[model samples]
Target: MMMVIVSYDVKTSDPDGAKRLRHIAKICQNYGVRVQNSVFECLVDTANLELLKEKLLDQIDETKDSLYFFNIGKKYHHKIEKFGSKDVIDLDGPIIF
Candidate 1:
């Protein structure tokens, strides 16, 4: 799977910027992604990477700019997953509300 690391520095750090980002993120959900700290780590087929790029571009206007995609997998290969007590789920079946 191709992992896409996208970073963008917005001209407007207002809600507009965040809104656009969230919109794009919604589209990216079609593939597979984990958005953290303004970086979208997308796991997808190598062939679909371009498709993901296109979707991101569609969300952005001609105004934003450092918008870069760093293809990682060869560079860094390790990342940790953290959990919290309140976020834990039972291994059995249904979850209590």
Candidate 2:
């Protein structure tokens, strides 16, 4: 599996825009862990990654919303560093609840 970071900015000024934003966020949750309100960190194989991208693309409006996928590869652990009070989420560990 490869580590991927998905971030998005959806225009939510109207009701339709808000619904789309929520739908996009829901889709991200199925494929990865949500680290922020509009960002997710996912570890998936290439095939699944492609599928995730397709799903996200279909939900977003190209003219009004933006999505970004950062392919951090398999060495994400070493490449990522954190500061401040955010607890690092263990994506590969068992969920306790």
Candidate 3:
């Protein structure tokens, strides 16, 4: 699996824009963890990444909104540096319920 950093900005001056923003966040939640207000860290294969991109694209308006995807590849542990309160999750590690 590859790590993908997804970020977006939605024009939220109106109700439609606000709705779209929420929809976008919901979509991202299904695929990964939210690291910030509008940023997500997703670990997915090529096909799943494509699918996520498609879903995000569909929720955004080309003229008013913007979306970005940064593929961090398989070796991502060293590339990221975090100095904050929330601890980062190991996407490749076992899930503890």
Candidate 4:
């Protein structure tokens, strides 16, 4: 598995723009854990990563938005650390709503 960091900047000033931004966030949520409003940390295989990139590209308007993917390799665990109020979430855990 590879650790992929996905970030995006989308410009919007109208209702359509708001919808677009929500769509982008939804797409990222399908593939990773959101670490920030516009950042996600994804753990996926190479093929899935490629697919994710394609899907992201298809949704973004290049003329007004930007997307970035950083493949930090499989050894990313060794380099990761956290501090402050943020706590890691276990995605596999049961959810109560």
Please tell me which predicted candidate would have the highest lDDT against the true structure: 3
What is candidate 4's lDDT per residue for 9-95, written digit by digit as tens?
988877776777898899899888998889998888999999999988888889888999989988887676767787776444564
lDDT of 2 by residue, 1-97 (tens): 8899999999999898999999999999999888888999998999999999999999999999999999999888899787877677888888786
- Please give, for residues 1-97, the per-residue lDDT of candidate 3 as tens digits: 9999999999999999999999999999999999999999999999999999999999999999999999999998899999989888888888696
Clash pairs for candidate 3:
none
Candidate 2: list runs displaced more than 4 Å. none
lDDT of 4 at 3: 85
Off by over 4 Å in 4: 90-97
Order of candidates by lDDT, top first?
A: 3, 2, 4, 1
Model 4 TM: 0.86
Query: Distance (Å) between predicted and true CA of 87, model 1?
Result: 11
Best by TM-score: 3
TM-score preference between candidates 2 and 4, better one: 2
**What C-alpha lDDT do the candidate models reach, one value each?**
0.61, 0.92, 0.95, 0.85
The full ranking of all candidates by TM-score, starting with the best, is 3, 2, 4, 1
lDDT of 4 at 44: 88
Count of backbone collisions in candidate 1: 0
My TM-score estimates for the predictions, one after another, are 0.57, 0.94, 0.95, 0.86
Residue 78's lDDT within candidate 3 is 93
